[model samples]
Target: MLPKSILEHTLVLDIETVSAAASYAELSPTMQKLWALKAEALQRRLAEEEKMTAADYYPEKAGIYAEFGKIVCITVGVFTKNEEGQYKLRLKSFYGDDEKVLLQDFSAMLSKYFQRRGQQYVCGHNIKEFDMPYICRRMIVQGLPLPAPLQIYGKKPWELHHFLDSMTLWKFGDYKAYTSLKLLCGLFGIPTPKDDIDGSQVGRSYWEDGDLDRIEVYCKKDVFATAQVLLRFMLEDPLALIFESADG
Candidate 1:
């Protein structure tokens, strides 16, 4: 179980990403060739399955890879103590059509708030594997400096105290099995964040519908759900807590 002190200082976050371009045809010639190679490699792994062209798979699967995609929205939640001494999560989102601008905004927010505090942690489901690395890579791709907490290059595994992952906690040192946030939410009786859209549809939503709002809402819900999952891990009653938008 997480200590109350650690829980209070944690910031839960989720990010939504999409392909750098709306379609394969929109990619630069160099990127198109790279993607073709990537797709070919992926297809080779699925040789037993029905074959589909690389272009057909690019829109749906490319965003999960940071090298081939860009972040569209990053929704963050913080657990704040109430007057009653209970904690509630407050959420904020940084999002835009311009990846560099959004990343700059997010990096600035981290430097201003989270980085100055020594023990503050950034928490999310599967963050150690996906979200954290993706953020770091995209920041580099955009030529932004890595925030202090994110600069985990030479730190030994035992020294990473400022990064919390609900999935890692659930593993309890058993690293073989994987768990999805939605699946854990279901198991713990928390609301799943996929009612409207799942990660698989994010690329389509951004490229086809131009709906950053929808993606932001979905990302925010995941942030909330991740916080609730962490609360559950701490043996707290997740249902008793409520999250409010920081804007409101």
Candidate 2:
């Protein structure tokens, strides 16, 4: 089992996103033109799929870009002491159609919690490259003030002790290896977050099925799995059930 110390006050986060519009046809004429150019620039990565066109790429790849996508859910988990003085995780999700409202609420919670607890760790799987930067970009797009922990502009590398990435930690300085959260969970024997749906299905769920609730649940599961993966990194039992207590 994991030591209580490692989990305490550490934040785990995950986000679910979808294209800002339901379909390529729904995008503004200007945005469609922009995406066409962007797709052409990225076409080299699809060397084996030369048949795929820009319209074909939008549904699959656009959500990974904050400029083209919208975050439908952002789930954050933290270990807190229960009434019995035992450490257990608590998960909260901010989600809705109005991205600005959810972002504001999430930042407010971050500010209030960190103000009370002092500076601390903010962690997730592949968080350094994807989650944090995407959030910052979206916040700027919305003209929202960044939370203190996210004001990373021009800070020295060592100054970001509060930031952590489970994937980066596992790489052991192997910069080329890109490990997915699901792969780490399986390697560590933690429950898979893909039981319900995968990231590829998230956009379809939101735009076609209108299943935001399912997306929120999937996001929480990933956050929980991330915590489990981190515990394994601390040389603890990856199956630790402490996170089972996390209330969403």
Candidate 3:
């Protein structure tokens, strides 16, 4: 296979989200009512033994839904040619308790990338379904203006080539099942640096432990893993494309 460099003009991104409230007890009356409604739909999908009230499931489930959660961290990486003529992924992050501010900053960076590169891609695993849409919805919820890349209101599918998904590539057009990036990395034998935490524990780490730094590290590793998977899809050696953090 040809080593088509999707990374050249692509921005790799991953986000960490936590429940809007620390606990179900903390939700406002309106939100509590709303979550109960949402939770009924969630509960119906579970087996009998797994059934529970919406409040009981709130801690574990809320963060996954954009309506019930807020992004605490968004890490982005881009493949760059370093000083020694080696390729490195430069990473930048926008994160914190303040969702509006983080989203605004990320939007500004996205706008700049579009202006600078004129329609470069945004790559991630499951971004087409999760990351991209969640970001767009959250921006709308916060009343932020949608950047051009995100402004997909009436655009045809053919016009939206700037979004790439490693998981989608792995599907080979067979959309039968979902594949995890960690699993893909294992199959490709690409080393990952994700020992500390995982996606399931992100909400706890954020809400209970109050650790944004740890979450940021996890998100960054996800970005790297995503980039490496794309390289493997293109049949390129991931090691040769040196991984570097330009977060300074």
Candidate that would win on lDDT: 1
TM-score of each: 0.96, 0.91, 0.94
Q: What is the C-alpha lDDT of each candidate?
A: 0.88, 0.83, 0.84
- Candidate 1 C-alpha lDDT tens digits along 89-166: 999999999989998888888888887445899999888889999999999998999988889888887777677888
Which pairs in model 2 have colliding backbones? none
Model 1 clashing residue pairs (backbone)? none
Per-residue lDDT of candidate 3, residues 1-248 (tens digit): 42465557888999888889998999999999999999998788779998987878899899999999989999999888777876688888898899999999999988877653334788899998899889999999999999878888776756666778887778878989999887888888877656789888998898889889999989988888888787777777776766677676
Please give the TM-score that candidate 2 achieves against the real structure. Answer: 0.91
Ranking by TM-score: 1, 3, 2
Q: 200, model 3: CA deviation in Å?
A: 0.6
Tens digits of lDDT, candidate 2, 1-248: 22447567688899888888887888999999998888888886666747467788899889999999988899998876677664456888999999999999989988987653234688898888899889999999999999988898997767776777888888887989799988998888888999989999999999889889999999989998888788777786656446542333
Worst 10 residues of 2 by lDDT: 239-248
Let me know the TM-score candidate 1 reaches against the reference structure: 0.96
Candidate 3 segments exceeding 4 Å error: 1-5, 83-85, 116-119
Between candidates 2 and 3, name the one with more favorable TM-score.
Answer: 3
Q: What is candidate 1's CA lDDT for residue 118?
A: 58
Instruction: Supply every candidate's count of residue pairs whose N, Cα or C atoms clash at under 3 angstroms.
Output: 0, 0, 0
